[model samples]
Target: MPPHIRIYDVTQNISSMLPVYPGDPGFSREVLKSLEWGDPYTLSALHLSAHAGTHIDAPSHFIRGGRSVHEIPIERLIMMVDLIDSGTVVSPENLSGLNPLAEGVIFRTGSLTGYLSEGAARACVDRRLKLIGTDALSVDSSEEDAVHRLLLSNDMLILEGLYLEGVPAGVHTLLCMPLKIEGAEASPVRAILAPAEWHQWIL
Candidate 1:
C-alpha cells in the first residue's frame, strides 16, 4: 500500500437501487435468516446478473469460446489507468495524445451521456489497451454488439456501471477485481483508484 496515496471508490453500490441495462435482471436480496426471526446469525441471499452494478465483462461475453471471468489474469485487473472525461460520446478524437502505454483507460462521461462509439472502441483496440472502463451502463448502448466484439476480440476487458461523478480526469492506479466465477461470462467488481504510484504495490 502507498501510505501517501488517497483511494477513491469508483464502484457503484450493489443494491436494489443500482441501475442495470434494460432487460437485464436488477439486484435483489432475500433475507434467508434474520436476527428478528430469532436466528443465531443473519444471512441473506443475493440475486443479480453477473453484469450488474460495477462489473467486468469477460471476452466470453461476446465472443464464442473466449476467456471467462476466472480465466482473466489478476494482473490485468489492476493496472496503470488513464481516466478521461469524454462528455457524451467517447470518440477517436477524444483519445488523441493520451499515453498509449496505459494498461487501462476509464471514461467518466456522466451516466446519461457516457458511451463509446464503435470508432472509439476500435481506436482503443488499435492502442492495444488491456482494459476499458466507463461510468455508463454499457460501452455502446446503440451498437453494443459491434463495440463489444471489437474490443473483446482483442482480449480487452470491459468494465461498466462505475460511479465516477466526482473523479477527475488523469492517470491513476486502478484496482478492480471481479468475482472468480468459473466459466462465467462476467462478474461484479469493487473498483477503486489511487495515485499512480500505487501501481507498484498492486501485485
Candidate 2:
C-alpha cells in the first residue's frame, strides 16, 4: 500500500446534466418503476456511450480484428507508470525528461483538445512506452497525432480524455480498469492513483 495519494474524482459527469458531444446521445435517467406514495422501491436506468466519459479506447477502436475491451491482456494495462506534467505539447528536443521510456506514461496536458504530435509520439513509442494516458480529450490529429497511432499500433493502451489534476508527477500505483464489454471498441473507465510508497513493504 502506497502512502495514500488522495485520489480525486476526475471523471466527468455522467448524468443528464452532463454535456455531450454534438450528435452524441445525451445522458438520460428514467424511473422504470417508482417508489413514492405507494411503491416500495424505485428502479432507475441510464443511457450513455461507453466512450462518453473518461474512457479507454481498446485496440478494436482502430485496427480491425483488434482485441475488444474484454479480450485485452492485463500486462499492458497494469504496468508501472511515469507521469509527465509537460504544460502542453513540447518541442521535438525537449522530451529528454522522459528519457528511458520503457514504462507506461501519463501526460498531464490539462485540456481535452486531443492532439497527437508525431515527433513526441515517436520518441515515446519508438522507445517502447507500454501505455499512454493523457488528460487531453484526444491523442491524435492535433499537431501530428500519428504518435498516438504509432503507440497503439504496437498493442499499447491509449488512455485519453482523463482529468488528472493534483495528481503528483511521480511513480504511483494505478488501478485503471475499463468496463468489460464483449467485442466493444472501447469502454468508460474509473482511473485512480495511490501514492508510490513501495519502499514501505520492502523494509
Candidate 3:
C-alpha cells in the first residue's frame, strides 16, 4: 500500500496584521453587508496590494515588457522543489552546491524579514531555476530591489512571505496557485507543500 501523505500550507494569513513592505499597501477589508445587520447576506470588499501576504512576483514586476501574473504557465507553479535551510544570509557561496536537477527552490531563512544577496540571485539565474520561494517578506532587502530585478528579468517566478515555520528542508512538491490577474505584475498565492514521496502522484 502507498504511504499516507501529508500536505503543509506555507502561505501567510492575509489579514490587516500581516506585514507589508515599507511602501507597499497593507491588506484591508470593508464589510458591505452583514447578516447580523439584517442584510440577509454577508458581503465584503477587499483591498490589497498585488504583492500582499504570500504572493508570487511575475516578470513584469521589474521588467518593462515582461510577462505578467496571468501569463505564467501553470505547470511552472507546481513542481518538485528543493528546500534549503539557508540561514539568514543567502550569498552565492551558500547556494554553491545546489541541485542542478531542481526546477524549484524554496529557502528557509529563519526570518520573517530578510533578503537574498545580489550574488545569490545571480547564482539562481545561472542555475536556470523555474521558481524561487522564500520565508522572507521580500527577496530583496529594504535597501535595494536588485534580487527581484535579476530573477524576474530572467523570467523566473518568485514566491515571497511564506510561513515555513516547521517545514523540513529537502525534496518536496510545491503547489503554488496565484490569482489570474490580467496585466498585474504580481498576485497573492496559496502555497502548499507535500513530501517528495507524493510528487509522482501529484504531478
How do the predictions measure up, each by TM-score? 0.95, 0.81, 0.95
lDDT of 1 by residue, 121-160 (tens): 9899988999999988889875357888899999999999
Location of the lowest summed lDDT over 10 successive residues in candidate 3: 93-102
- Cα lDDT listed for each candidate: 0.88, 0.67, 0.87
Where model 2 places Cα greater than 4 Å from the true spot, the runs are 1-5, 8-10, 17-23, 90-94, 99-102, 142-148, 197-203
Clashing pairs in 3: none
Clashing residue pair totals per candidate (backbone < 3 A) = 0, 5, 0
Error of 1 at 8 (Å): 0.3
Query: Once superposed on the true structure, which residue ranges of model 3 sit more than 4 Å away at CA?
Result: none
Cα deviation of 68, candidate 3, in Å: 0.4
* Candidate 2 accuracy as lDDT: 0.67
- Deviation (Å) of 144 in candidate 1: 3.5
Question: Could you give candidate 2's per-residue lDDT for residues 1-203 as a string of tens digits?
Answer: 75444755556556776654345576678878787846688888878877776778877777777778998776555555667776566334435676352367777876666454677777776767767788776676544436555766777778776767676786765556787789988787787765544323422
